[model samples]
Target: MSPTGERVAMATDELQATLPPAVTVYERSVYSDGDSTFALVNDADGKRRLYVAGPAIADFDGGTVQGDGQVFPLTYGNAMALAEVFPWLEPTTAGRQSAFGFGDRIGLATPGHVRAVRDSDLVPVFAQQSIREMDRTGRSPEDVLATAIFGVFQEGYEGGFVADADHLMAREDVERTAGVGFTMFTCDPSEHVVADADSMSEEKVEAAFAQIEDSEAILDRYAGETFEAKTDGFTWSDSFSEIELKRAAVKYYEAIEFAEELYGWVAQAVDGDFDFEVSVDETETPTTHLEHALIASELDRRGVEVTSLAPRFVGSLEKGIDYIGDLNEFEADLKGHVAIAETYGPYRLSLHSGSDKFSIYPFFEEYASDYQHVKTAGTSYLEAIRVVAENDPDLYREIHAFALERFDEDKATYHVNTDLSNVPDIDDLTDDEFPKILDQDDGRQLLHITYGSVLSATDENGEFRFKDDLLGTLREYEDDHYAFLEEHLGHHVDLLTGEIED
Candidate 1:
């Protein structure tokens, strides 16, 4: 019995005499609400008891006692109370070991993927097979496939994969990608082709203007007829004499109209929901710059808010010192973009291809404090492979080969060339060649090294070179990546949202 008057034990000599020495017994006072109503006697005799206070205290009452001394109704709460009173009464620790292994060790990238995996009840093999099938068919719906692929993680996942239309030069492509459910897009006005008055002679300028005027005139002439035909629901059973000319005029007008419509549509689509980015190519021709300004003005006139404006000021130059020139140029262009973003209200100025340029962090911090977003992608992924490769050469080689094959395929599809003169040639080279290659040019070196590292980390078959090592390496990389961002780029990224720490 406890010092508080709770019964602690009951004498059972006869049961103890026949039972093994390991067997023991005890008694405990149990309560209900505020009433001390029963005494719990536990023994090898299987809880034989005596009733002392309730109405049926004299009878066993089917092994249940009703009096104050009787123990009645072994409810779950009572069972817990009994266990608390006597620790040995509970199940053994050995019996409580987890039935299934791998508890709480796994982590996920987002929450949405977790729900998808849980709801679908998919295992890793199933998820991998689904991704494989998706890759083969290229028909996976954006949301569904993103969820399935990312759902393999056990924690820190939110459903869906996010991809940005990195640089889109045409309104049609923007609308097309958006229709396919791409939420992030970049519209680059610097790619617009514009007439260059400075580069061309006066006669050439006049001729170009004349051609434009003639085209507009031809369009105006048949514009009324085409509108009338369309409004009247006219159907053509055979080719008409002026059909081609009229069609061209209609197409030209529609293209212009599409541009205006697209500005409004993208603005509405991105408002308060997703990031709509615009990039200005500082290296573009003067005419293209002017055209982009016109587009921005049109967007402003249409009441469409610009969210972010990125300027590509740096190029693949040969010298590290040349980056200083690039920086100066970037600063000049950044001012214009900043002015635009500030005037538009809530818009930010961003930098693109922000990789391997760790030296530019201070510059970004100084100028882009008010900006809303900053993005860096390929750098961290490259660093991830590098870390894994340091520990395992074979795995590194596999990943490297895979990345190279994938990149080669991408290059082929996109018609990208390495500009052999810009890269090092090691054929029949001396020992001095390696150092020369490393010291050649910072910009080119960064590009080559990043690409080479990525290629080296992948396998020949275009698979992730270290598929088996992905989880551990990814975790380590994610940790280091976040730390890097916090230490170096955190000022630009939003600490709360983790989106460019704006």
Candidate 2:
């Protein structure tokens, strides 16, 4: 207090003076790569809580900060844009201090959300009410935050703040989240940890386990010898050792065991009470049958409540499958899996990665009533980008830069070596040519241009441009997109209650 001579004081209890209230924070497990953890923080008594996770303490500790304790160095343009978007984010140059009060969890998508959570006001009703608002009115993040705050201060929602772990891959993820006070958790059973294709068979399942064991042996050898030799002074041997390869055996064997153990632990922590859900990719190769069994068995074993069984559809069948025979077979396979989930009873089948298809609404509606929950994340975010783009082309450029940077970072994090040649030559195309490229039905072209049909330039980037130009260039199309979403997805206010009429 003596720096400016406005006040000169001495504090006997520095910690008490500097620290914020001891608010209990809740985190939900999402995807992580061991670098950061994501969670949704809600003030127990406040109205707003944020859902996102960021880096571990180690990454934050001793980290230098830029202006106002901003830990990471951001470009001037990006910083300015953020400040424009969130004025509260602008702070004095001490660099933002690390809010890594809790240790880090792994995952990618959590960090952005964590940043949002940390910087936002806590609202108690955020969890219980905002989701409904999101479902019905299709509220933006800002809108949700505002609603949550109003509810909390005005005694709106009373069930405490709720946050969902959208999709998690590991048991430790769940454990870490639970420790952080998250009550909702959803496990993703789609990732195949097996190394070889031959492990799909019963005999090969055991062989796969053996192969994993051998692989671990090889990895251990490298960890002990090669890695240590390379680093000399630094060793990640313990980290590698903690990675239980046997637990990563094919979905048929080890996945179920891992799920059982996770559910059991979660149950024990909550006094024999547990609420668990599972998610699968509808387009996963070899299907997710073994993973499904793992989920069902684990749920039964622990008697944990199964909230929702969400299946994420990846690429379109028309693109993923080559021939008519393959497409028919793929559809049959998907139907069979859905049937199995329905047969299990007490499970609600959900669909993920849903959007931009004007035709899939019927298919979604056919099962919508039968399922407990349905979600589409990227679609909404994409729409928001589009909205921003329509209002300001400069914002569109900034967002594009941000997205491309994020994509590059994602590739590096996954250790992927991408071939630029593999990417279709679209640089030569003009604005007029872009429409023709999208209209083509060739799977190869789609694969080359789109990222395995997981993301599309038209839907992602073009839509961004469309959104930027929405209010100005094509107000009609803007209204169309919004109206279409509202009509098909049902009003975003009460997603669970509202049904879109056919």
Candidate 3:
């Protein structure tokens, strides 16, 4: 922020005098050069234009420049770039508060999400996608944020939205996503979570801990030590056996180290303010009550300030389905988890596989004031598939067949239990009845997990088999798809906000 010149700041009268007589100045920002400012003005005909008010004016000359300082296009694609120049246009973290992350897997679900979110108190994370998904869909984080910017402009939504670099797992990906203008990073540490660490024997846990170079350092810090942490209403004071301490450390120490590395990198890598969401919800076993406190307390001790934490709750929160576990048990576990979070920091209690888990929304509503973040990505994609099934039978049938063919392979990474036999055979149904497959839980789960394979599937000829056709068909029936998303996603929002009718 060095001074480019000795030019004095303009007064309001001087600024008005410099503008066109008939134009209205909406915004003005000091250019990278301190002597000049750029104004976002509306012309007499109501078209938005960028007006440069400066003495140094050789570069612009009413044409686009190719170098560092260029005239931005009026296209929606430039919204993100414009936001960079004007900080007001950029969205920041919504803080440790109640928020909903509506991830649009196809990049077409934002407008519907916007419609659903505009009426509620919950903040909208309209541009939410994981690094895994970006790889799956051949998209970069920039594409995800750009698409959301356009969606916001289309619907005249200026309330602002989150550009979440969701489920990020590596250090290099952290630099890449932050450079692409994401305001939130969900660091997923599931890769380092040992399978069934809660059930490991003391010998096994010690052996696992023996692999760490400084295992003794961790043991000296927490082993045989009583942890006494409290909030106004809750307190957790417990001592762990050396084995129990090593077990928690073994399960999460590597993950926490990775998170620490990524957090420090991203905090300095990006230009603006951002938030961190730590996710340990990808492990095999359910996250134990003590495990939740262990991770959070250790994170605090390591100087990592978490913005949100996703626990592996007691349930099968499978894809495109309701919570498949005891609600009472979930509520009990959730209350304890929330208490742990409160005792440490009032960070968000984030739900990871939170799409269409209708039965659990009541819990979110119950703890609305306590701050919760529920993430949903595949449900919108599911609804879009529903649209395709109803609009174009042939394409839907082709995808159905393709999904079944790729189900087992694609489902390897996800936590779903869709028995292929449970899905009704398409051959047994008429074209008119095939779309109803979306209603069946098994069928929805089958299609849900196979999206990556289906999207990237190509034939022997080395060309896209169904990707182009699917997008084209979806585009043709975009309105139907949007309406469908609104009804489906709106109900989800309603369940969380208590706006649902009988």
Candidate 4:
């Protein structure tokens, strides 16, 4: 046998001899970097640890194992070390494909994401979070990436995965997540998107437009010029008149400039190529075709290659619920956006706040095809709560009651219309009926947007009030947790990968 095989054999023998009797090795996880062998093992109590053997064991991070070889606890440093040997642990670009990003606010949802994507056509972005989520949950970029690495390893998923620095609004956000090896930089330029431009008076629009550098050159390029675009089954044309050009420029010029600068920062921070997703989906006004064309063309002119762009589609795509709007209008609007994408760079059109927008997935598959990316952040946390609701009803009840009190304050940042009265009172629901609340709009949004408070809330003595119980219960009932995630996230993957109707 070859020397590498010999090393793997020797490591396997050592792992079998040294590991505690109670620890069951994840058989498929055994891998070798030609010098050392690594595997994931689950203890009798269900805790996971890494088993490494051979001379290279000293180079990897983690504590020593019992009988032979070294065992590393799943940690940020160890995850980094392991990635050096198995490069799949590191994030990579998903390119222009039908991809889905599963955001794990609490960092334990990747295993289920892996299972859901294993047999699907879409690429899986396992480590995805925003700066707001990090601040609220007190989780760093490293924590997000590290937890995903460990979960990916535990499940023996080696098909490859992408990591997204989702909703990055500033240079600092890009730098922080880039330092931790995130490969997808989703630049959120909504702050610079002038939403009032839609209703601004001609004088106001002109003022804002004049403030932009090289306004005349921009106007000369776009004003009175017709641009044609097409997608699979749709063709469209858009032109901006003098006043319309000024409005479009005022609405998105700053945002385009911000993305250009942020793109440079991303290029500087990331050592190699990274997926760049420009997001203006958080704005109040919908992004018209003319606006999208301007943003895409300007970014292209600036030499910024966007892997995907998330426009603020017409209608309401609120958090944690099915879409609420006229589907026909949304489809028409989506066709225009897809046409714009095809005309420019043929990039993916991402859907932000797309946790449970079930009614619209078919439209995306039909219009965007492979040029699409759906991001779902907070839904996994909701599924985790579902596990808690199913297993620990008392804990779920306590969390529900607290969520009610915190909903008004926490709902400030999220774009949700959850009327408190719509949610059934905790006392009115029996223990067996507790899990049913997750299916309701108000109850789901109430629990969905209040995750940060639920995870970080403390008692009067300054100790944690719900964090420990919430996590501990989830950990104890991990199988159920993965099951729920698999069911919910799997449904998403299935819907997005269905056959496109003719």
Q: Which candidate number maximizes lDDT? A: 4
lDDT tens string, model 3, 1-502?
Answer: 2123222245434554655576554422323344455544445544444545444334344534322222333444465544544443566687786788988877767767888787888878988998889889777777787667656544545567777889887778888878867889988877777766678888888788899887988877777777655544555567778777888888888888888877888888888778789998887677766777778877888788898889989989998889999999998778778877877777988998898899988877775345788899988888888888998899999999989888888888888878888888899999899877998889999889988887887899988887788777766776787788889888988888878731
Q: For candidate 1, which ten residues in a row score worst on lDDT?
A: 96-105
Instruction: Give the worst 10-residue stretch by lDDT in candidate 3.
Output: 1-10
Q: Which lDDT values do the candidates have, in the order given? A: 0.36, 0.34, 0.75, 0.85
TM match of model 4 to true structure: 0.94
State residue 135's C-alpha deviation in candidate 3, in Å.
1.4
Clashes of 2: 44
Residue 99's lDDT within candidate 3 is 81
**Candidate 2, residues 331-364: lDDT per residue as tens digits?**
4444544554554444555544332332443443
Q: 239-337 in candidate 4: lDDT tens per residue?
A: 888999899888888889899999999999989989999999888878889888888988999999999999999999999999999999999999899
| Model 3, C-alpha of 131: deviation from truth (Å) | 1.7
TM-score per candidate, chains pooled: 0.44, 0.44, 0.82, 0.94
User: Once superposed on the true structure, which residue ranges of model 2 sit more than 4 Å away at CA?
Assistant: 1-162, 169-182, 189-192, 195-206, 209-249, 269-274, 280-304, 311-331, 405-502
User: How big is the positional error of residue 387 in model 4, measured in Å on the Cα after superposition?
Assistant: 0.6
Q: What TM-score does candidate 2 reach?
A: 0.44
Candidate 3 or 1, higher TM-score: 3
